[model samples]
Target: MKKVYTISEVASLLGKSKETLRRWDKSGKLCALREPMSNYRYYKKEQLSFFEEFNNHQIQDSIDIKPQGDYNVLELFAGAGGLAIGLEQAGLKCAALNEIDHWAAETLRFNRPHWNVLEGDIREISFSGLRGKVDVVTGGFPCQAFSYAGKKLGLQDARGTLFYEFARAVQETSPAICIGENVRGLLNHDGGKTLKGMISILDEIGYRVIDPKVLKAIYYKVPQKRERLILVGVRKDIEIDFEYPQPTKATYTLKDALKKGELFNEDVPLSPGAKYPVSKKKILELVPPGGYWRDLPLDLQKEYMQKSFFLGGGKTGIARRISWDEPSLTLTCSPAQKQTERCHPEETRPFTVREYARIQTFPDNWKFAGPVSSQYKQIGNAVPVNLAKAIGESIVKFLNEKRLIEQSEKSLIAI
Candidate 1:
């Protein structure tokens, strides 16, 4: 492994601009070293230890950590089994999975024949029988606005939203812990009122909601720069604490995901992928690896961008081609969409279905039971499997601690 990295290499690795690195150097935040002969700025690999995703042996060891016992999870809104599969990988057994999408439910049942999959609207399902039987209740509830009837947001305030169904499940199951995941924007949705409402609802149901956190997928061995905001609630009656999973210091890149490297044993299997129109393909051919619409020639940029060319913000996702060396940008439901084009690094085409699954850390044998577009949507919307596994391990550790504490109390009472 190389001990030193050039300015450009460091910038790419850290996902920062060269100008930002120079600013950091000036401020002594992440100072670069001067090469003795050339005086060019360079960074030592050791210096990168400050970043949570720095490549390190300790990080690799952490990734090998596993759960202490067999915990059970009841998943809601379990689209395509990304979180369910991840928890299984971390040693948790799935009690049941509920998904509204028929194709997604079929995908789950097709991949894991033994999983109890319930397909329908969440509002119609009753989890009363699962009370005290399930260890955890997990969901990726869609963010929706709650009716502000009073100063305090109550359960009824969220009645029409998907989050209401998630909260209802948690109340019905009365699990030791409940986890709800959403997009990062949820933190500030409706000016942060939506999340506050959720926290209040969980509190009313006797679960103490932890301060929500956004886990970056790249820090958890996922080969994409995706982010998911995780909300954890522990039963207030349980005298135990729940901690979010610690991020690993090692990061995987597109190469690890698509090629035979640390993340996979074999190269990505080829499958059907979305294609760009002839006119769009010609425009993307000009964009190099790591390049976007802004990299095109002046006339072509204007022609391709049209009104977007004059837009203020950097529309970086337009005509973007992923680089093999870096983690891929967060995937969208449709790879060929004009707003969120995820073009291949070497080819003018979008990533194949298998490649999409690979980026999301799905195992090679796990197949999606749906059309190509549906498969892409499922993979794109999923919480990266590696990230979910890391979280599952943390939940297991918490459950073990709770069990030990209960055992100690029981022995004292016996004495």
Candidate 2:
């Protein structure tokens, strides 16, 4: 690769626009060089190291870290066993998983026959029996607005929402720690009141909520640039501090996800995938790898994008073709949607089921038990396996430290 890249080249590499690059240069986020003769701006290759894709390496050291003992986990809103499998890989045992979707529950049961898969509305379930037996409680609770009756938000104020059930589970199980994950938008949802309400409710339940942090999937071996906000709470009685997992310096790209390389031992297997309409396929064919609707000719752009052509934002996901060199954009439940098309790099079609699983870092052997569309939805909604495993390891470390402190205190009292 060249040591210096032009403005357009850097833009394409970063999946951003030239105008955005200019703004970054002005703001000192990513400075550019002015050529002596042509007065053209260029970026140094070393400067690109700040991005995850450029810094990716084959060695992944964190995968070797193991749990100290047989810690148990109770997962809520578990979808297709993504988080469950990851925790299992980190040496944490899954005591039970609660999910409402029938197909998702079937998928979980199909893969792990031994797991206690509870398929029903969480509001109907009682977690009191698991109290003191479970060490950790984790859930990917949907973000919903809580009715703020007053300045202070309580658990009762959140009734009827999924989060209320999650809080109730924590109160019932009285686990040492609880983790809640949601979309990155949750951090700013309802002008930030929603997240604040959630924190207050956890406090009311005797768990001290940690400052929420959004974790980037690409930084944890997932080949997609997806973000999830993580909310952690430690029981008030425990003095030990909880820590979030640190991001790995290495990253993976589309090639590593689909082709035989470091991320997988074999190439992606052929499987069923969604197809685009003939008209949509024709338009997408014009878009080169890593290009979107903006790359089309003026006449074609207007025809394909319609009113969106004159829209304010980039609308960059329209008819987009992913490149092998870069990480993929976040995957959606449906790949063929106009707003978020996930077309293949070489072929003019949407990614296959196996390809979708690979991008999420799922093992090839893990099968979905539903229709093709249902399979896509299950895979799309899952937490990336690698990202979940990283968090699981952190949970294990925290629990282990707490255990040691308890044992030492017991010995001191005996003396």
TM-score of each: 0.91, 0.92
Report the C-alpha lDDT of model 1 over 42-157, residue by residue, as the tens digit.
88988997874455324533644455566789999999888998889888899989998988999999988898998999899999988878999999999998876567888977
Which parts of model 2 have CA positions greater than 4 angstroms off? 1-19, 22-29, 34-63
Q: Write the per-residue lDDT of candidate 2 for residues 56-174, one digit (tens) a residue.
A: 43224554666767799999999998899888888899989999999999999999999999999999999998998899999999999977767999888899999999999999999
Cα shift from native, residue 245, model 1 (Å): 1.4
Clashes within 3 Å, all models in order: 0, 0
Q: What is the lDDT of residue 33 in candidate 1?
A: 97
Which pairs clash inside model 2?
Answer: none
- Candidate 1 positional error at 234, Å: 0.5
lDDT for position 122 in model 1: 89
Candidate 1 lands at a TM-score of: 0.91
Task: Give the worst 10-residue stretch by lDDT in candidate 1.
Answer: 52-61
